[model samples]
Target: MSDFFIDIIDDDGADQGQEAEVVSGSSSTWKIAIIDDEESIHQVTRLALSSMVILGRPIEFLSAYSAKEGFELLSSDDEIAVVLLDVVMENPEAGLQLARRIRQELGNHNTQIILRTGQPGYAPEEVVITEYEINDYKTKSELTRTKLFSTIYTSLRTYQHLVAMEQSKLGLQKIIDSSASLFQERSIREFSEGALLQINALFNIHSEGIFCISSGPLAGDRDMIVAPLEAEQHRIVAATDIFKSYFGKAIDDIDDITTKQTLHRTLASKEHQFTNKYICLFLNTPSQWEGAIFIKGDIDEERLDYELLSVFAMNVSLGLENTKFFTQLTQMAYYDMLTQFYTRHGVIDRCLNTAVKNGEIFSVCILDIDYFHEVTESLGFEYGNKVLVSFANRIQSILPADSVFARLHSDVFAVVVFDDKPLDMEFIAKQCAEAIHVDGDKLRFGVSVGVSQFLPEDNLSGEELLRQAEIALKLAKEVRRGGGQAFTPSLATESRGRIQLLGELREALASHELVMYLQPKVSLIEEGTVVGFEALVRWPHKEKGMIPPNDFVPVAERSGLYYELDMYVVEACCKILSEHSELTRIAFNLSANSLNRPELVDDLENLLARYGVTHDAIVMEITENSMAKGGIVIDTLERLQSKGWLIHLDDFGTGYSSLSYLLDMPLNAIKIDRSFLLQLHDSDNAAVLLKGIISICKDLDKKVIVEGVETDSQKAFAMDAGADVAQGYLFYKPMKLEEAVDLMKKQS
Candidate 1:
């Protein structure tokens, strides 16, 4: 050890490289503090070891003339790695006391202390060194320049190793905790943040830094994670408190352009790049999102950063990729594939979950694209798809931030808005109408809107709220030009009543609670002579004495029960015709809904054949407006005409009457509506209008029936107008189907 120290302190100033290496062990500098009473002791110590180097660093000295001064000097500076103390200072125990103060009062366990004594009997090397926690003990006679260097070198090296071990313990612990969080965490932003936290702990860096992800997906990446952003740009994913404003900002916007350029190069090269002052590592995960981990700090970590930080980057990158995978999976499950809106099931499922607050209220609105099927059929589904997307975007732009939207069906969209303030559904409906019309107006289309609100008090599911809106939407579609309507109490009441009626009607059909009434239409020339009877359905309920046709028929039409009712009437009329061969024909009514049936011809033909009745024994009556809405009404009517099933334009002079009905529609007769006949006594114009209508029918070689003639004067007026048939109470009243059958039997 003595020869080694002697060689380290070469007096010739030889081996400068060896001197530099032998001083501090590194190119870095280590500070040493010297404490003694004699000025010569401090000078000699400086001269011997000032040029010494350890760990590639040279030694720097700080001196104190007294024990108290030494304590004060060491107190101000903590980086002093080693303290060389003389035992005989201002007092015999001065160096020992200073050592005790450094260990106890200053609480610095890291700085090495070397104790030396000039007197042997005053203090034993074992006693003072053991008692005061001194690092080493030597006498002035033995501490030559070589021995001094050996002592200083050994002490400094031990101090460096101890510090490295302590730092490694703290840094490794922090890293273990951080890695646990990385594996357990799910957010890319949070994972990136933890990366910076662990990096700061490991490298002793406290400056602000940004973690940026600003390149295309990495190799072997099948998912286009960042393709949705404009031109696949890069973004700052996470940052420290001081740099938090940089989050979500583009990499080009970073104030540190040099750092930004370096990150770009690192991403381009797919490798790490280090500068004299900055540390940046490129993270390549097998996903489309590339990242750059950067730090501009007080300490340079480049020496061991690749070895140490590479672990952190690998763990963090895997965590980030997993997070992105989960995020995309969730988006695909909950969002509409075409418009990026919420799916109906997705919104409903979310609402049914525990995420909603206990007392939260939401207003739900539904928008329907008017004649959407027509648009899709005429313009093609591709154009219709564009219209749907455009309409959705417009609605999203019009609604508030917290609103949730979804495409519920092919042409229907559902929206849910939080009710933070007093909900004004009318205003929401208006906004919805406006949004729909922007595209609708250009395309010559229209839309209807209906709105309802969530009322937990009502105990309605999200689906029920949607149903309420649909009921209101049905009413809106009937309105002119198809406008907006909010779900009011009246709509709910009407819907409830209709639903109840539908249920009762279904029950009545099963139980045979419904019966038929026949009103006879007699010729004016043949007094009190019954000819043909019109079939009128009557529902006699146990609860509500009688259900009128006006009330129940409309409900049946709206509820799609009209088809059943029409079939029931046809069967009843066939039974009557099968009983009495003398009956001329029974005319049955056809509503717009029933007239649109695709299987109407098949049904009627089967019924006639089953009952052994000719098609000539039945006359089908329809109002003028009913035919306008059914696309196949004209074709079906022509088919019926060909089969000798007489088609009559019933209530023709009142509803949707057109000259086209006389010229184009196949018709055996026109029945002037009851209104014209009722006004005959008071309004001369009504009488003149009736005469002209009858005249037109005569000119067209069509039969004219004057219906609802309740008085002798109405009958006389009908005869004067050249009517071929008169259906009025003045001739024959309404009778039961059995009574009509008996009368027909009697006539036969």
Candidate 2:
């Protein structure tokens, strides 16, 4: 092996292209401390070490006759990577004490120490090496020039490895912490801001920049940049301008888009050797969130940073892509992409299709925009589409719990109202008509609604019932602007008899024929836990055993009783809960009517307060149908959260349930529709679907309630699938409120 001085020479050589200062000729400089009473010993030590060349550099030996003088030299200069000590100096064993002080008091872990003792007995090799933490100990006579170089070489190399390890550990920790913090931030802006701060601290450079780009029409368009004052202006300019310009065009391309190479090359600049950029392109479609491009300045302190930068960029890109994917998946499944309303398909699957065994009365209402086609032509298709979405949003806000609202057709929307009292469908329709007005202040156009009471006759099919309401809607339009018509047999007696019935159904809810029923949700786990009960509305015709909600719920909502129906449901639920305080709690299904009311949340709060029920115990089940339609639903749900109601996204995996709901709403639990569970046995993808739902709910920190588990296998599957709660025939069907209370007492 080369002499110890040779290794330092190799490292400090100008050829290394590092910050290495030259102290002498080709000979390497060594900081040697000579401590001896004899001046000759100092001279002799210097002469011997001077001739010794480690690598291409000759050693420059330091000399001191006393330990005190040697300490002074050591204290003044820390560049002495290695120190040589003498055992006998101004005081015996003085060298040994100094070595201990260097290791303990000075806390210098990088410097290497070697002790040379004239009198070896003063400090034994074993004792000094173990107790004093000195790297090496040698008798003066035995330390030849060759042996001395060997010992120094060993100590310096060990120190180098230790320093490298410490730096590696620190770097890894910084990366982990930054990644974790990014995941915790709620918005992209917040994540970017946090990352900027962390990267600045980690690199110890004032210059930091973040430029993000979103692709496509639906995606957000923005640009932001931030940097420290001390950071070079030219560096920022090159990084920001060059990097952004390069990625901007590349990311703009709709076909064959990628973040690799094309964008990464632009990040190369004077301040940094190489940089990494990533592009995540979202699929072209109607969605809340879309494509994203992230570019980061790369500072390569280590020679291996090229690969690390690539890995970092890849990770960031993947995260952004995953978020966008989740968001789009939710929208397609839960909402009406065109008008941002609950699609007809989603509402029926989640809300209207509930397992209603006993005869129950629900109300149905259908409303059509008056002269919508003319409005579309006059306003331009794009503006018309916007107005339609906006109009749907307004009407959606007023829907009540137990009511499912949806855009049934291009110009028609349907709502199923759940209420105990007779709903004034005319008033509900008029309120919706006003909601559709443009600019909130202008009466842009009128809306006409057809109403129907859910009679057993309506149970034939959801389509037939909706058709009946549409018939009523025609009568409403015939009357005048903003006129609401309820469905009646005589109304149907006209050419568009369904339209006639819609005109009369509005009169029926006012007479109070509609009644309310409560369906109990029992919890198998957590003994005595009823969990909650669902509020169901029923209509008892003087002749029919019970009218099905499917038949009439839509009529009331479309005819304008949606808001009143919501109040009725809330009032009845409160009464039931008040009557059965010992039961776990009660939940009510809500329609767009109640949700749209500016006073809805406030009213619910007051009712809960009056009933002495805490918000925690009261859950409002909102169908994926209503959630699909955006606007007031988002704001209303947020307001309801502020008021303390536990809002649940009912029929979770069945609607346009875009990822926004997971992040935006404070949903306590999600109920898996019974259909999804039933399909589990029929389709090969049953387990996969169920597992996906469970995983999403678990990740969002919400509970999952499986709606149907009739068979033993279904129950076992639900349990194994990690369902938090189960409700079906296997447990118990929707029974009378009194029977539910009796069962709860027995279970308790």
TM-score of every candidate relative to the true structure: 0.63, 0.37
Worst 10 residues of 1 by lDDT: 217-226
lDDT of each: 0.74, 0.60
Worst 10 residues of 2 by lDDT: 229-238
lDDT of 1 by residue, 1-748 (tens): 0122111344344224246333211245789888877789889888877765655567788889789999999889988998888877787778888898999999988899988778755555576677667888777778887667777777776776566556556645543444454222224455566667766545444456788774332211112232334445677767887677677666777787777788788788988776656678888778656788887754443334466567767766776676556545555555677887777766676653322345567777778877889878888888888888877877788788778788887988887877755455455455555534434556544667787776557677667777878887888876633577778879889888988998999899878788889998987767667779998899989989988998788888877888998888888888878877777689988776767788988899899999988887888898988767746888888887888788899988677778787988889998888999888778999988889989989999999888888888888888999998999777667788778878877766
TM-score, cand. 1 vs. native? 0.63
Candidate 2 lDDT by residue in tens digits, 309-390: 4454455445445443543443455456686555676555545555122335776787788878976677777767777777
Candidate 2: residue 696 Cα off by (Å): 1.7
